[model samples]
Target: MSLHHTASQEATRRTALRLLAGLGLYGITMPSIGQAFASDAPGWPEAAFKAKTQDEVLAALYKGKLEMSKDVTIETPEIAENGAVVPVSVSTKLPGVTSISILVPENPYALAASYKLADASMAMVGCRLKMAKTTKVIAVVEAGGKLYAASSDVKVTLGGCGG
Candidate 1:
């Protein structure tokens, strides 16, 4: 067999082994992913997560109105083939950003996730959010005791419940 052909076969074998290992690890962790989050983090905002509508969720989380700011940016795929695991990242150049929250308007629960940051912490956060269907993803940043928001639409071809 030619050396080039042998090398290609070796690369394919390595890729398959990697995929298998990753799948095994993911399967082991899948069960624990639904476990309750245990931490010292105060202000869980349980009500916000239970809020059904975007307006109600915003009111539940923040005391004041949120300002749409170009300074805060939400990064998400324009089209997600699998809604089960859509990657999202939120960041802001604004100062004193204490918290970041992800919102999905079309989901049963409007508030998908939230993150807390301190004065010395970075103003950026990344998470994987499940979307039931195509919808708008909003990032809300609490900075300097004020609310700022940025949004982007993601088209989910498949519902996030399962395959």
Candidate 2:
């Protein structure tokens, strides 16, 4: 066989192996991708039940009963220009997460949102949220019959206030 042909074949073999390794790791990590059974209407509770102030929301969502888990992660921009439409995403590496919810305390309603998951599946949910002002955005994951949470701050800037 020609040297050039052999080299090409070798590169293809390496790429195929890399692809297989990635697939194998994915299978091991997210085995329950399509088995998450969540409620049709996993509604959020009243604001009083969630929190009022930003700190209160963080405390309620990420403290004591709501322990932060390494399996869950929340993503949001460090700075948001228009508080009316801030993008946020919640994702979990844990298996069998029944549902996930996002909450913003300073808003008119503290329970910003909730999302049900498929049975035996990992979930990654993204949505836009409104912030009355700079506030904490939290992700709460219901998995293995318990609740886990993660939180991050989103800085909202007015015309001259961010200075």
Candidate 3:
């Protein structure tokens, strides 16, 4: 083939190879993504929605520690339809939390939230949360070797996981 044609073909082949490689990588990662939820973080209770009260949820998330303070703030909608996917945000007006966690009492899992503090100065973070029913959502902040907590209720109607 002519030089120009040869160059054009080479470029096309390179692009095609890159696309296939990307797809292959995505396929390999698909299963592992779900694995992140395979095990609950340490210090979390091994119970399934056993928390009938907000304090129970906070205690579970904190795992018996009064080190938490009241600086942590929990944010969520006053109402929600699909319990499976809810938006939650946590912030601390005090200083910073070394970690943050979310919990829903009606789901099969009690430990619905967990986060490790990357920066001691980071005052806030948000996440898309999931619920199983109309339940209270709690956010726990671990800072200064203590656990501080806040909570809100979300009323799920349609249920996100098709309840």
**Which residue pairs of candidate 1 clash?**
none
Task: Count residue pairs with overlapping backbones in model 2.
Answer: 8
Lowest lDDT sum, 10 consecutive residues, model 2, at: 39-48
**Candidate 1: worst-modelled 10 consecutive residues by lDDT:** 1-10
Residue 120 of model 3: what lDDT? 37
The candidate, 2 or 3, that scores higher on lDDT is: 2
In model 2, which regions exceed 4 Å deviation?
1-64, 159-163
lDDT, candidate 1, 1-163, per-residue tens:
1111245445754555566778776455344645686431223556778899999987776778889999999999999968889999999999888888899999999999877675689999998989999999999999888889999999989645664
lDDT of 3 by residue, 1-163 (tens): 0111245445754555565778766454345655666544323344423566555655544445544445667788888755556888989876545666676767766667566565635768888877778888767676655566777888877845664
> Candidate 1, after superposition: displacement of residue 106 in Å?
0.5
TM-score: model 1 vs. ground truth:
0.71
Model 1 segments more than 4 A misplaced: 1-42, 159-163
Top candidate on TM-score is 1
The better candidate by lDDT, 1 or 3, is 1
- Report how far residue 136 has shifted in candidate 3, in Å: 0.7
- Each candidate: what lDDT? 0.80, 0.68, 0.63
Best by lDDT: 1
Give residue 31's error in model 1 in angstroms.
19
